[model samples]
Target chain A: MIEVEGLTKFYGAFPAIQELSFNARPGEIVGFLGPNGAGKTTTMRILAGYMPPTSGTARVAGFDVVDQSLEVRRRVGYLPETVPLYPEMSVFEYLTFMGSLRRVPELEDRVDEVLEQVAMLERSESYIGNLSKGLRQRVGLAQALLHKPEVLILDEPTIGLDPAQIIEVRRIIQELGRERTVLLSTHILPEAQQICGRVLIINRGKIVAEDSPGNLQAQLAGAERLVVAAGASCEQLLQLLGGLPGISSVRAGSRDGEVEVATVPGKDLRPLLARTIVEAGVDLMELRTSGLSLEEIFLQLTREENDEQAGG
Target chain B: MRNVWIIASREFRQYFISPIAYALATMLYLILGGIFFINVYFGLETGQITPDGRIVIGAMVTILLFATPAITMRLLADEYRMGTMELLLTAPVRDWELVVGKWLGAFGFMSVVLAVTWVYPLILHRMTSPGIDQGTLVAAYVGLLLMVAAMLAIGVFISALFRSPVAAFFVSLGVMLALWIVGSLASSSGTMGQLAGYLSFVDHYYNNFYLGVLDLGDAVYFLSLTALALFLGAQVVEARRWR
Candidate 1:
């Protein structure tokens, strides 16, 4: 439902997002994972029709963001990083006002529907300034959902919330993803891993990697490590495991009766190692594969991009 | 047009819900009422009836010079400071809709101030024989409304330029004062002086409506100035997207 092609944006001489291209299909949650100042917000702003890209094109629901901004805006619901709201307005009043601005067909009914969806019906009469941060964020979400747009672009939706509130928002986003296209941006790696169906890792105005969280982790799980508890001395086991095919190195682990093994990239030495241990009459107590976490994968991707930029 | 009215009504409701609108209204009525009472008291003492409310109209023009900025300073500045401009600009509404809506909202408040001041003329009519010249009274009010509309437009434009309401308020006051005093600084004779006089807001008011003479030139002058200010304010709002 959203397509961005060679989208570059420059503020004065500095490029915020350069030659970035990505797409999010309907009923999919695409997490834009990036560190702070990694052009996440800039990319989302361009898609939301808040600003035109310096070059290239961004289309939402088949409408070009720059050429048909109003139509694009009508089809996309954006929650900015700041969750902008009028503090003086009541929750119901704010949503009604936003609904009217979005030209929603049944503004009052739509306001109530969104309010219920955000679980904020009880606090509809309360002033926005008097609400807690979590409640205000929900109100922000209600306003974004007021018109029931086809695409939802959220910038750091879970930022500045307590852990419980974060989980609640994640649940809402996961639920929302089942109905429409959601392009959520966040610096939090776990947020992407836990919720997004696909992840786009961006760094320094460029997308470094894009894949599912599991796929990203698996792709970066090169030189996989293994831990084994055996009925042999660490040195002897190391010697035996090191001699096996695909086993690059073996060393004594921190605990007694344990040996650590490292295999070459794309190599699975578990079955071979098990058979060798059994034929040698060595007891195998335990064997486990330790793959890279999404956090480590994210760090590696961004760090490698930074290093490549620095080297070039 | 519907979007414009939506934004306009929201801004208008905001003015009444906040204490600032009431405070401004109180200050305006006090100044206008105080000047009207003093003029009547002095007229009674001299045993001469001056039923022409032109002096009150003149004071109102000066009062609006200060009061309008207070009303308009928060139009766009508060939106920026509070971060609501993102919500506003990203909506399906056009830039001109937001600008014109806010300008009309502030103008609506100024209209209330003008409406309240009418009581002074009503009282003058009740107290004086051969009361007020209906034509002069109507003409004076038309002039005041036009001046207020022009000043509010200028205030809205200045407000759009700054993120801080205080800065917007002071800058608007400074600009209005400069425009008000430009005619006094002119020599009143040379071609350059004539240009300066024509540019001055004070000259337009005094030469036309303040003297109970309705001049179409002054009317067009204020309307065109208001339109120019509003157009510039809309441009500023649109430029923010590029920034």
Candidate 2:
């Protein structure tokens, strides 16, 4: 439902996004995972027909964002990062105004439907300014869903909400994604892991990694580290485990009953190391594979990119 | 055009929802009324025969210098300041519609101001027994309406360049004053002065509309200026997508 090729946007000489290309299939929820200022907003704006990319092409629902921006806009629903809204306008009034701009037919009925969907029907008449941050965000989402566009490009949809509101918004997003193409940006790894079917990890405007959550971890983990708790002496434990095939290094932990094993990249030595350790007279207390957590992987990807830039 | 009306009506309603429209209308009525009262009072004391309502009508263009900025300063500035410009631009509406719709809304408010000022002439006719020629009122209204339309267009154009409504208001007032004064400045010079005088908004109003003559040239001047201003405003809105 969304296609992009070489999409780059430059604010004067500074390139916000450079030669970036990605796509979201119909009815797929693709998480745009990145930290703040990772060009997520810029890319979403271009896709939503809010702005034209300096170079390259983006199409929404098969309409070119630049050449057929109005058409693309008609088919896309976008919620910006800040959720900028007219505070003086009531929730219903704001939605009606936006729906009318799209020339949506039977506008009031549609407005009510979306308001209910976002769980804001009761407060539809309240002034947007008087509503709390969570309610205002719901109203913002209501406006985006007012016209029932086929594709949703939400930039930080769950931002600035309390914990409960965040879960409610995510549940709503997960439901919405079941029938529409969703490209949502967020810095929260768990948010992406919980809801996004596929994750596109972006850093500094480039797609550093893109895969399913489980697949992404396996790809980045490369080599597995094993933590072993055993009855052997620290030096003896290290020496016993050191000569095993594919064993790169072995280090003793702070306690006498703990040791850690490192292996060659792309190899899982857990089974072989376990068999070797069990055969030996050393009584093993515990043994488990230690893979990098999602948080660590996220940091490592962004941090690695930063280091590469600094080193250059 | 449908989109333009949708946007325009929302803006017009916004004026009433806020206190700006009521305040502006009250201020215009009080200032114009005061000018009329002083004209009659001073004329009676100085032994001047005529307390012309036409002069009071002419003075409106000046008051609108401040009034136009107030009406227009927030039209575009608030959009940028509050970040609603992204919402408006992302909709299916075109750039020209956004600019023209806003200018039309401001013009609608100014028209009501023009209509209310008709009471001044009505008062004059009642007191002086057909004091100012009624036919002249039509020509005067035409001139003032056209001039208001042009000034509002200029104000809309200026508002687009700013995110600060206060800055837009002051700059708009300054630009209107400079344009209003350029005609008097023309008295000092020669050929260029004639051209400069043509740029003055008052000259276009004072020579034709203020005198009760609905000259086609002056009407064209205001119309063309209105078109030019709205065109520039549309261009500014369009430029944002590129920038």
Give the top-scoring candidate (DockQ).
1
Against the reference, the lDDT scores of all candidates come to 0.89, 0.88
Score every model by TM-score: 0.95, 0.93
Give Cα distance to truth, residue B97, candidate 2, Å.
0.6
For residues A142-221, write the lDDT of model 2, one tens digit per residue: 88888888999898999889999999999999999989999999998989999999998888888888898878887788
Instruction: Please give the TM-score that candidate 1 achieves against the real structure.
Output: 0.95
Q: Per-prediction DockQ, in order?
A: 0.89, 0.80
lDDT of 1 by residue, A1-312 (tens): 999999999999999999999999999999999889999999999999898899989899999999999999998899999999888899989998998888789888788888888888889999999999899899988888888889999999998889988998999999999989999999888889999999999999999999999998878886788999898888778877778888878889888779888888887888998999888899998999888898898888889988998999
The residue pairs in collision within model 2 are none
- Among the numbered candidates, top lDDT falls to 1
| lDDT (10s digit) by residue, model 1, range B1-243 | 988788888888888888999998888888888998898899899998687856578777777888889999999999989988988888999998999999998888778768888888888888888888888888878888898899999999989999999999999999999898898967668887888888899888877787778999999999999999999999999898898
